[model samples]
Target: MIRSTLFFALALTSFSALSQSTLQDSTHIDLQPVSVKVYFAPQSLMSITSSTQVVGPKTLTAQGSQTLVSALNTVPGIRMEERSPGSYRLAMRGSLIRSPFGIRNTKIYVDDFALTDAGGNTYLNLLDPLGIQSIHVLKGPDGSLFGANSGGVIRIQPKGFDALENQVQLQVTGGSYGLFQEQLSVQRKVSDRYQFSFDHSFLRSDGYRENTALNKKTLQTSHQWQVSKIQQLRLFALYTDLKYNTPGGLTLSQYEANPRAARPAAGKIPGAAEQQAGIYNKTLFGGLSNALQLTESLSHHIALYGSYTDFKNPFITNFEKRIERNLGVRTYFSYAKPEAAMPWQMQLGYEGALGWNKIDNYDNLAGVAGKQQAMDNLDNRQWNLFYRAQVELLKNWNLEGSLGLNKNSIHYKQRFPEVNNPTGDIKFDAVWMPRMATSYQLNRLMALRASIAKGYSAPTLAEVRSSNRSINTDLAAERGTNYEIGYKFKTANNRFIADLAAYTYTMKDGIVRALDENGAEFFSNAGEMKQRGLELGTWLTLLEPRNFGFVRELTVQAALAYNHYRFGDYRVANKDYSKNKITAVPDWVNTNVVHLEFPQKLTLHLFHNYTSSLPLDDGNTVFAKKYNVLQAKLNWNTTLTKNTAINLFFGADNIFNEKYSLGNDINAFGGRYFNAAPMRNYYAGVRFDLK
Candidate 1:
C-alpha cells in the first residue's frame, strides 16, 4: 500500500510540473499569508515572538469534516488522538503524559471567552468540526498573558463571524462503520451594521469495536452589532449533546488476540459490553463581548461567559454523575502610539472564573446505578491579573514583555461515607509568571525571534477529587520555565514558506498519572522533567491557478518534530527512575501532505503520518510500537447558478490499515493500555450552498 501510494503521489507531482511549465505566462495567483490574533493583537506570522501555528480553513477542510484529529496533527509540535468516534485527547509538546482522556493543563478560548472552566478542564469534544473556522496553537507555555498553564494554549475561532454576504448551506455525509452526519448553516447581514449566523450539526456512528457507538448534536449561533461608531457588541451561544461508548483499554495479549474486541470479563469483574460503559455529556455555553474605542489611541474590550454541563459515565466499576456550573469574565484595555517616533503599545487585563460541581458515584449494576458509593461538592475559583507591553525599539527590532499574577483555591465537602466525609479547603499561594521576547526582521522575507516564559498549572478538580473519592490536598502544582528561539522565511512571491524553532523546557513538581488496583485513575507529583525539542515546517506551492491546464494548483506541506524528554531525579516507591524516558512521548513525529487541483473543479488531498515508538510506563518496562498512517480525499465543486453552488466529496482514512493504538492508557495498573483504532474506512458527502 505504501509503495502504490508513493508512486501515485510522484506521478501526480510530475504531471503537475509539466502542466505548470506550459502555463508559465498564465495570470499569477497570489497566495496571501494570514494574520493571527493569538496575543490579543493582529500580526503576521513572522512578526510574532512566540512559537505559534495557525491552521487555516483550507487545511481544516482538507481532511474529513467528522473530526479535527487529522487536521490538527498536521501542525508541528502538536498531536491529537481519537480513541473513539467522539472522544478526543490533545497535546502540545509532550503534555499528553498527564491526559488520559480529556484535555487538561492547557488553556482554551473560544473567541474572547474562556472555554476552560475554573477547574482547569476543557470539553473540546463538545464543539463540532463544522462550526470551527480556524485554530491557533501556541506551542509552549505563556502564562504571562492567558493564565496559568504548563502545557500550552489553544484559541478556537468559530465560523460565520467572517461572513459578509447572506448565504445558506446544507450538507449530508455517510461513511463506513454505519457513520452518518448532517449539517446546516445560515448567515445574514442586516444592513451594514448588524450580522448574525446559525449553525447546526448531527453525527452518529456504530463504531468498529464492539459496544462502541457515538451520537452527537450541536447548535451554535453568533451575532454582532455595531452599536455605535465607538462601541460594538457581540453575542455567541452553543449547545451540544454528546454521547459515546467507551470500550475500555485492552491488555497487550488481549489486543493481539482480538483488536476489535471490547474489554472482556476478568475474574469477577464485568466486561465493558456487559457493563455498557459509556459517557453522556450535555452542555450549554454562552458569552457576550463588547469592544469600545474610547479614543483614537485607546480601546477597551470585555467578555462575560457562562456554561452549564450535565455529565454522566457508566464504567465497569462505578457510575459517575456530575452537575457543573461555571461563570467567567475577561476584560482588557489597550493603548497604542503608532504615530510616535518610537512606536509602542500596551494592554492591561484581568480574568476571573468561578465553578461549582456536585459529583455522585454509585455502584454499576449491569449499566444501572445501584447503591450509592460516594458523593462530593466542590467549588473552585481562580483569577489572573496580567499586563503586556510591546515596543518597536529600533528600525527593525521589536521587544515585548508580559507578566501575570495568578491565584487558585478549591473548597470541597464529602457527603457519602462517614470515613471519607472531611470538610476542607486547599488554597495555593499566589505566583508570579513573567515573559520577555524579542524579534528582528532580517529582511522582508526573513525573521529571527527568541523568548523566555514561565509556566505554572494548578491541579484540576478531577485530579484533586480523584476516582478514589479522596481529596488530595497535598498534591502540588506543576511549575516550569521555557526558553525558545525561532526563525521564519518566506519567498517574495509566497511560493515557499518555512518556520523552524527549538526550545528547552525544565519543569519541577511534574504531575503524573497512576491507576489503582480497581483500574481507577489518580495523580501525583513527580520529581522533575527535562524536555528539549525541535520543530520545523515547510510549504511549497508548485503551481498556482491556471486557466488552460489539467493541473490548476499543486502544493506540498511537511512538518517534523523531534523530542528528547526525560525524567530528572524521579523516584517512585522502590524504583529510582531518574533520567528515564518520559511516558507516552515519541522521539520523532512527522507529517507530509500533498494537494492538487485539476480541471472540472476537482481537487485531491493526500496525507501521511509517521510516529516512533515510546515508553508506555515511567519505569520504561513497556513500550508502544511505532506506526504509520495514510489518508486521502477528493472533492468536486461546481456552480449550479449565479446564486447557487454544489460540492461532492469522497474520503478514506487509514488507507494502509496499519494496526496501532490511537490512545494509550499510560501507567495502567494491569497494563491494560491499548485502545485500538479503526482500520480502513471510507466516507462520501455532498453540500449545497445558496447565496
Candidate 2:
C-alpha cells in the first residue's frame, strides 16, 4: 500500500510538470549553433562520405526498449542476431561475418569508453534504454573516429541535461517473465558554471527461458565547476553492476519443443561431471571521464575507462563448470572548431586486455562441455589512430574524409595433457579507410550526396580456441571495401528530412567458423563474400512536440531496405557449396512509426516492424520464417494540483500474439528450427517527479 501510494503521488507531480513544461523540437529547420551543439561530432552526420544516421533520444523514449540495440533494429542495412537473451551480434553494410564468441567485426563506444567484448565484439552488458541521449551508427571504415573497427561502429551518447531547475524523478516497472525495474534521478542547475546531476537505476528479469534471468544496476554522475573567469572543467563517472544466468544454446529439436526449454546435458560439472549444468554470472564495469574548455570553440576532452568481467559455469553440457575472466582499458581525444568551414576532429586510442580461460572434458563423444585442463593464460593488446575532416568546398557543397590504423598482439599457453603447446605472436597491420563524400545543397530543402571507403577486422583468441573442451584459435584477419551513393532532401529550414542510399561491397579473406581438422567447429579465414543493398529512410513532423490538439503534435518515420548476397563458389567439408544466401541475414528489413499528441493531455502511438526469414548458421541450410510485429499504446495525463499531475499508460507487444521464432534447430543434423519468437506480452508504467 505504501509503495502504491508513493508512486501515485509521484506520478501526479511528474504529470503536472509535463503539462506546463515545453518540449523541444528536434526538427526545427535551422542549422544554428545551438542545434549543432548536441552532436558530439556533427560533421560526421552532415557529410555524405561517412554514411551516418542518428536516432534521436525522443525516439528511444517512445520505443521504451530495455537496450539500445533493440531500437537499432529499425535502421536499414544493419543486421542484428540475438546470440543470447542479453547478447546480440551486429553487422553493418554487409560486413558482419563469423567471429569469435567474444569478438565482433564492428566496434562499439559509449563516450570515451571502448566497451568492446572480450572476444572483440562490442559489449552490450551496460546498455539501458532510459540512460541514452542519442545513438549514432557510422558505416564503413570509421577508422578516422573509432580505432580498430573494420566493419563499422555504434556510438551511444548518454542524456546530459534534464528538465526542471531542481528536481527528483523516480519510476518503477514490472512486466513479463518476472521483469522489474527501479529508476531514480536527482538534478539541478539554476545558475551557470555551478551545477551537478546524477541518475541511477536497477533492473531484473526472470527471463523467457530457463537459466536466463538477469539482475543489473547502473549509476551516472556529472559535476561542472568554474576554475577561472574564462575556463571551466566538468567531471563525470559511470558504473554498472550485472549478475545473471546463461542457460546455454539449445538444439533445433530442443527449441521446437519449447522456447523456454534448456538442455538436459549441461548439469554435469556441478554434479561431478554431469553433462548438463548452469551457473550464475557476475560483472562489474565503469569509467572515469573529464572535459575541459578554455574558450567556446577551443576545448579538450579525455577519459580513462576499465572493466572487470567474469563468466563462471562450473557444470554443463560438455563437461563441468568453466570460468573466463577479462579486464581492459581505453583512452580517447577530440578537437573541433565551428568558425572554420573545413572543421576537423581527430582521435587516437588503445585497448589492452589480459584474460584467463580453463575447461575440462568429461565425455568427449558428444562434445558437450566435457573438458578439464588449465590453459596457461592469455594477454591481448591493440592500438589505433583515426582522423576525419569536413571541408566545405564550393557553395552548398561539402566533403568529408576519414582514415584509421590498428594492430593487435596475442599469446596463448597450453595447460592440459593433450594440448601442451604454448604460443605467442605480435601482428602489426595498418588499415587505410577513407571516405570522400560531397553534398550539393540545391536549396534549403534538397541535396545530393555520395561516398566510398574500405574496412578490415583482425582475428580473436577464441577463433583459435582449440583445446580439450573447445576449439583453438586458427584464423587470419578479414578485409573488404565498401561502395555507396545517396541523396538527402529536407524542407526549408530542415523541418523534414528524407535520405536514400544504395551500397555494394566486395570482400575477400572472410573469417568464418567451420569444422577444422579435429572435426570440430572453430574459426577459419575463408575465401570470399559479397553483399549489395538499397536503403530508403525518412522522418517528418506533422505537428510540434507537446502540442495540445488533435494532430497538434505528431512525428512519423519509415524505412525500407533490400540486401543481396553473392558468392563465387562455396565449399563446406571440402565439397562445393556456393550461390547460397548468407546465413542469418534477411533479404528485407523494414519499419514504420506514428506518434500523435492531443488536447487534455492525451497521446497515442502506433508502430510496426518487419524482417524476412533468416538462416540459423552461416551455411543458410536452416532458416527462420519471415514475420511482422505490431504494437499500440495510449497515455493520458491528469493534473491534480499546481505541482502535480498523473499519467496512466498501457501497451502490448505482438498485438496478434502471432507465434514465431528466430530459433533454428531443424537444420542441425538435418533437422529443422523448433521455436522462432517468444509469446506475446503486455506492459504498463508510471513515472514521478519532485522539486
- Which candidate leads in lDDT? 1
- Cα lDDT tens digits for candidate 2, 1-691: 2322332243334334434544554444221111222224444234445456776655666644454444576576665644334545566765344533333667876655667744464446565666666677766655445555556787766654323257676767767777788877777784766676678888887666676667778787655666566555555566666655544445556666765664434223222113223333444555555556635655555555555554444333233333545555544444555566555444444444445544333433232544444434555666655555565666577766666666665666555554546566535466665656667767655667776777676666555553224444546676677777887766543445667888777766666654332222455555677878888766655456544445656666666678787654557686554666765567877776667778877788766667777766556666676776776777777766676656667767677676566423322322423433456777777777666
The TM-scores, one per candidate, come to 0.96, 0.82
Highest TM-score model number: 1
lDDT of each: 0.87, 0.58
* Tens digits of per-residue lDDT for model 1, 74-118: 889988888888989988876577774478778999999899998
Q: Give the poorly placed runs of model 1, Cα more than 4 Å off.
A: 1-32
Among all windows of 10 consecutive residues in model 1, the one with the lowest summed lDDT is 23-32
User: How much RMSD separates candidate 2 from the native structure?
Assistant: 8.0
Cα shift from native, residue 403, model 2 (Å)? 2.7
